[model samples]
Target: MSDQDPDIWSGIEDLWAWLDSHSPGDGQQSLLLRMLKLSEEVGEVAEAVIGAMNRNPRKGASHTWEDVESELCDVVITALVALRTLTPDTREVFVRHLARVRERSLGPGPGPRPA
Candidate 1:
């Protein structure tokens, strides 16, 4: 973790910059909107899962498991974008928060996560 080069995090930052440049609204407005978009993305994931499960008898299996997976990825991307919207140092913020969460969930001696 020594190097934080132009990788996924860089891409994440680039994505935020791109979106921010394209957006017409104010920074605060866009940040709020991004958060709402994350929620919408999450809802889409639920919808995709339901569709994959054919939960709605009326419309048997409208989505494949692959569709569900794509929707889930969208949710993650949307969430990361939202986090980026909230802070420019999203990489550090996320890493710090993730470490805290892992430490809280698993003790100090927490080893590699179960595969």
Candidate 2:
């Protein structure tokens, strides 16, 4: 992990904290709302990708690749924020889930032995 990775999580947590403070709520509704926010961000990513690719004939390259990249970053930040909202130990939860996914897809690895 890069030195800046931790800082990114810290920033996301700070943003989430600030938002939560301004709009106080907890439990099921809060979780649902956060998850819904992730979907909205994902939709924006799709829109940006389409615009970047000039897929819409009417728009005609209305957005650049940089816009797509920014939207993708938003999706990631939104996902992490949702996860943090769902659990205080967001890093641990994410690490464990990612490890499981890696193991399941790539098998146990000690320097990439053949499957």
Query: What are the RMSD figures for all models against the true structure?
Result: 4.9, 3.6
Provide the global lDDT of candidate 1 against the true structure.
Answer: 0.87
**lDDT, residue 3, candidate 2:** 68
- 2-110 in candidate 2: lDDT tens per residue? 7656687688899889878876566677778889988999898888888889898988788888998998898989898889888899889998999999999999878
Q: What is the lDDT of residue 4 in candidate 1?
A: 50
Evaluate model 2: give its TM-score.
Answer: 0.84
Off by over 4 Å in 1: 1-6, 110-115
lDDT of 1 by residue, 45-90 (tens): 8888888999989888999999988998788788888999888889
N/CA/C clash count, model 1: 0
TM-score result, candidate 1: 0.85
